[model samples]
Target: MNIIRNPKDVLSGLLFIALALLFGWQTADLPMGTAVRMGPGYFPLVLSGLLGLLGIIVVFNGLRTPGEMPTGIAWRALIIITFSVVFFGFAVRPLGFLPALGVAVFVSTLGSRLFRLQTALIITAVMVVFAWAVFIKGLGLPLPLLGPWLGGY
Candidate 1:
């Protein structure tokens, strides 16, 4: 008589619950006004509550169902993707938006099992162009194409 079933669902539910708690705590200081006059924390608090509720539901479902544990984790993809995102955040100021984004996208693509250099390059190029169009041109943001490290003021 196994008490725990569907390990994947339980883990996912726990993750969501943890995120909900984090966000909720972070927004606790902000003012939450009335419905008619919403404040900064209102939406975030609502979303957090919803996330917690969803997590509870998922956990219950997992407990009710009978399923096997997840086979294995994709450590390479996980590490690469996480590293690329952190790198982009840190490099954005020094390397600028375009270069940082390009490098991050290319490196992230390498995390895929079927990754190819050419494919990664193409994806990086497309993402750079799209970001430039949408964020720089369309939104009229002040982000430079190249930063101090690349000597683009």
Candidate 2:
């Protein structure tokens, strides 16, 4: 019989379960009407249930298997990605789509070990164009193409 005592694994499993539950609860507000055409809630609800199930499996596996250790959390990458999201949210309205998206892409790439200045710039530019083409031209999301300097109003 294996005696499991990995605090990190237990905590992570619990956290995943909690997050899944939270997502499920929040998604409840979305309409889940017909089976033929699933409402917004359907996808999130299903995904959350799957996540919670996975969390349970993780916890059970940890309990059954001893000597299992959790990997170290990448705090720097986490912080950078988080801040990038925040930057995207704040900059989207004021700085407009292109600039905001560029910054977001660049900041997000910082999390990767292979990130370089030139690569980041290239990726940012490509992503910006892609966003403009897809969201603005294709979907007509009305995202501003130019920055405030050009008086995009």
Candidate 3:
């Protein structure tokens, strides 16, 4: 029996619900103080509850409306994106934050068939600078812009 009229909404709702549950479970041990003097768990629990409520609404909406059939996931795109993230995790220390970020963004762009080298380069440069500012300048995280090999040490 076809239970879902909109597969995308149903799947998205389920994901949100799962995340909410996980978040709630993780915060269960933390003390939940009052709204005025909120504890560490307060915000996460409230957000998770709201997310769960939204998920229920979306699931009901999906069940009530007709939608397109579920399409196959783009495996190539998924793999490329995942690899890019993993690569960045490993590359950050050796390659430095800027280079690692550049490679990650560039590799992720390749996940799309419309990837253009020039566009990727431009995007990489912009994102690198943005990340540098946010992580290094704004937040003052001590991420090396250039690694030891590049004299960033």
Top-TM-score structure, candidate number: 3
Q: List candidate 2 segments past 4 Å from native.
A: 1-24, 31-70, 147-150
Q: Could you give me the TM-score of model 1 versus the true structure?
A: 0.60
Candidate 3's error at 118, in angstroms? 3.3
lDDT measured at residue 107 in model 1 versus the true structure, 0 to 100? 93
Residue 27 displacement (Å), model 3: 7.5
Cα lDDT for residue 55, model 3?
93
TM-score, cand. 2 vs. native: 0.59
Residue-level lDDT of model 3, residues 69-135, one tens digit each, is 6688889999999999999999889889998889899999999989899999899989998998887
Arrange candidates by TM-score, highest first: which order?
A: 3, 1, 2
Q: Which sections of candidate 3 miss by over 4 Å?
A: 1-5, 16-66
Spell out the clash pairs found in candidate 3. Answer: none
Give each model a TM-score: 0.60, 0.59, 0.66
Give candidate 3's error at residue 151 in angstroms. Answer: 2.2
RMSD of 1: 4.9
* CA lDDT of each prediction against the hidden true structure: 0.92, 0.83, 0.90
Residue 17's lDDT within candidate 3 is 93
lDDT of 2 at 48: 97
Residue 139, candidate 2: Cα error in Å is: 1.8
lDDT of 1 at 48: 99
